[model samples]
Target: MALFGIRRLLTILLIIIRFRLDQLIDVTRLPSWLCILLRFGPWRLVPAPQHNRGARLRLALEALGPVFIKFGQQLSTRRDLLPDDVADELAKLQDQVPPFSNEQARTLIESALGKPVEELFGHFETQPLASASVAQVHAATLNNGQQVVVKVIRPDIQRTIEKDIRLLYSIARLVQHYLPDGRRLRPVEVVEDYELTILDELDLQREGANTSQLRRNFADSDLLYVPEVYWDYTRRNVLVMERIEGIPVTDVAALNAQNTDMKRLAERGVEIFFTQVFRDSFFHADMHPGNIFVSRKHPERPQYIAIDCAIIGSLSDSDQYYLARNLLAIFQRNYREVAELHIECGWVPPHTRVREFESAIRSVCEPVFEKPLAEISFGQLLVYLFSTARRFEMEVQPSLVLLQKTLLNIEGLGRQLYPELNLWDTAKPFLEHWLRDRYSPQSMFKRVSHRLPGWLEQLPNLPEQLLEGPRRPIEMPVPNTDIEHLERQLQQEKRSYRWRVLGIVLIGASLMQAELAHWSPHTLALGALGLLVLALK
Candidate 1:
């Protein structure tokens, strides 16, 4: 495996050299020796391509294979990080690889479903409607005359991905060890996250479930539409879903031709994103233009049609609360609050100086906010904020990074649809409303009501556990007199027993108050009191 990895690494290097991608790197930032080597390498003998740098990069990633192509697709979303031309070229890197043989697709489909294609579907197209690195889709009609698309995982793609993932780890380790900021970047963790994401994509049944959940999320909503997944025909490698017809969200001209309300359409995209993240806590992580469409039925309202649900992201309750608050702070230009939230949420070290962090955040954000509301890029602001936070040693949060990427995609798409779309205006109100609802008394009551039964069930054992503390064998020193030792032990036990009893009584009182009052201030005080008593040594 190590030998194969070395050879694969060489192949990648050769591809980069062949495309002259080294030119893209800033040689001035490199070590003196490496700079000279790159400038005068033997590989430089090969003639450089006539194409521009961006096109060369796109072609080189294509040559590198599916994994790199997917990486390029992800990079394209970060327009804030890459040059506009490069980002634009990378955005054109679609999963339009040459399809495998139709006979192979039929054989795999049959093997997965345990039936012949003829017996399965009323009609199945031999030609693939779309071909991606991981899977390809073909138009089909079920026996029940349901128009659906059958997705078949590419044969042997797993072996290819496995090989590439090993190579990626090798590269990530090199980056982590060699680059000054590599540890801060957490490249290995990022690759691990990417590995999980890509592996999840290989499981068609999981994708089906994701689609079903998303469909249910927007069942009758006008904001977005998710297609129905047919479970009967779905498998680990095979997915069948309702065929959808809509204008690709990227087709601005076509949308304008249909008199689409571009502003409403743009704003709705933002609403759909926040609703998924703040309300549902589940969102489609891979929401590039290719996976999104605009419904033709509602030109005025402009409902979004989304597909490809392989990559999903969700935040913990704490993350949701903190992230919403942080964004609100950023929007309000409350840099001190933003800095404090970072430390409070453990995004930065607890020892981080709040004033210094606040100043850094202000330096990054004040200039951005100076722009007109319509011209401000909310996603870019986040990018800048994260970049600045790196100085304070803020570790990368995989879930938040995914959210940021999706936000960038949504912001770009919204701007394309309507350049004047103020993402701040669309998002602020939604987040404010979500935060209010999340912390409302009714919400608190619901949460308490749900957890009360569990708390009641645990009540019987609480006294014993609290009183016993942690079990450890007692070691007693030799005493001058047995009577003296016994007296000391007795006194110590009495004091310990009293404290334990008091702790139990306070906790019991708190639980009772919680049961009666739900989430009132008195109940909160009692709960804190119980915790404080229990924590006393």
Candidate 2:
């Protein structure tokens, strides 16, 4: 380690010792020698703090600084990993940080935008509206009289983050090497993932793009709203966006004052989440209460206003399909399908015993399903499922991890809005409808139509490529006897190839017409004719 990393590690050690967070670990689970060492370690000679293990851990993280605090926030979502008390305490870890001087913010913004603060905005507040680990926001008005918020990255934060991240890697290595469950817990991989996420937050331009994409995804929709980003004023270190006014989603009293339909608000929150994951495939991953608000205009039909698009999650086509199926199967209490889907999707090892995996899933899910639909937590169930699957050697999917965190945030927000919100009732129909649409003939036709042109372009070379395999010395056939046989065979193969090519062409044409004309009788006839041509071979 470098000098800075060593100093940072020592500082972390002091804080850990001060808080006595080592007690949070289960010493019995460690190797015998290590367990004995920990039990009689000199660190234990110091009188322990009065706080509980969870509190001590949380306090130690806070004392470590922004990066560790952020890690605590992420860890809190993994209810499947940490004990309940510890997770609850970590959930209390806030990203709030003291703001740098206003003059420093101004200088950074001016340097990023190549202009003075006065030239950039008609009015800019001297005090920050919100200060977080990576950046701070200030209320401002554009010269065009548009209300906006100016976000400036803390000057030299990158250096601080890099230093802390290096120390984190070092600590992760130590934990992985020393702890018994370290490989399973994946401390190193967890740190690597966190590094990518926190590093992304430093690039305001990427965040601005994410905000714009989310706004476009929810455009003209009442369920959620994303503020417009001012591209001209945006930079890698600075972002300016339209300011929104609404009740914070956590303020239940204020929302009630506005006659908000609490049940509707809660259901809409679930709808927004499903729509983002299944419908758009792009979702705001960091959707904690601080980044969400409720529009006051439509109390009867609640709309969510989301900000802080620094972290977003998306699913690939296969993941989306498997995830939807897994969710539906879980809701239907079909553990067999859930287990099968995990193996088929490569989430779990293919060699995993299906019945054993199914039994494991049932054990985790049956207890949860015993509760009333309204009381069950969809996110918590997923956490438990993932936890069980880990025993079958499922590698963590980063996208799914983000989705899990966002789901937990949404569920927490919904239950806060309305205690009796039935997440299963809200999400089941959506997943079913999406799955149906996903494999419908029209969808198949659309997919085939997209690839048909490329297939057609490649079709012309197929016969020649098939005939001439790899480069090799040509063998002369026995004079005229084999020549006639070769000629006959060539003729027969050409005819077969032509017939197959015609069948494919007809099939492509029929699918295109069916998609365009809504599957009329003519298109059906064309499809049948293509199948008949293929059958003739």
- TM-score for every candidate vs. truth? 0.84, 0.90
Candidate 2 on 25-69: residue-level lDDT in tens?
Answer: 778778889899889988997778898889989999999988799
- lDDT of each residue in 1-537, candidate 1, tens digit only: 778788888999999899998776666666788889989999889888999999999999899887889867866755434566887899888777889999999999999999999999999999999998999999999999999999999999998899898888887797676554556546687677768878999999999999999999999998999999999999999999999999999999999999999999999999999999988899998898989999998698889999999999899988999999999999899999999999998999999999999999999999988888889878778878877887788765778778888998899899998898989898888988988998665575456456556656866776675666445454876566786876677667766755755655665566677667666777666655655665773
Name the best candidate (by lDDT): 2
* Each model's Cα RMSD: 5.0, 4.5
Model 1: CA > 4 A from native: 1-10, 24-36, 50-55, 76-89, 175-186, 462-537
**Candidate 2 runs further than 4 Å off:** 26-37, 462-504, 511-519, 524-537
Q: Residue 422 of candidate 1: its Cα lDDT? A: 88
Alpha carbon deviation, residue 233, candidate 2 (Å): 0.2
The local distance difference test score of model 1 is 0.84
Cα error of candidate 1 at position 459, Å: 2.9
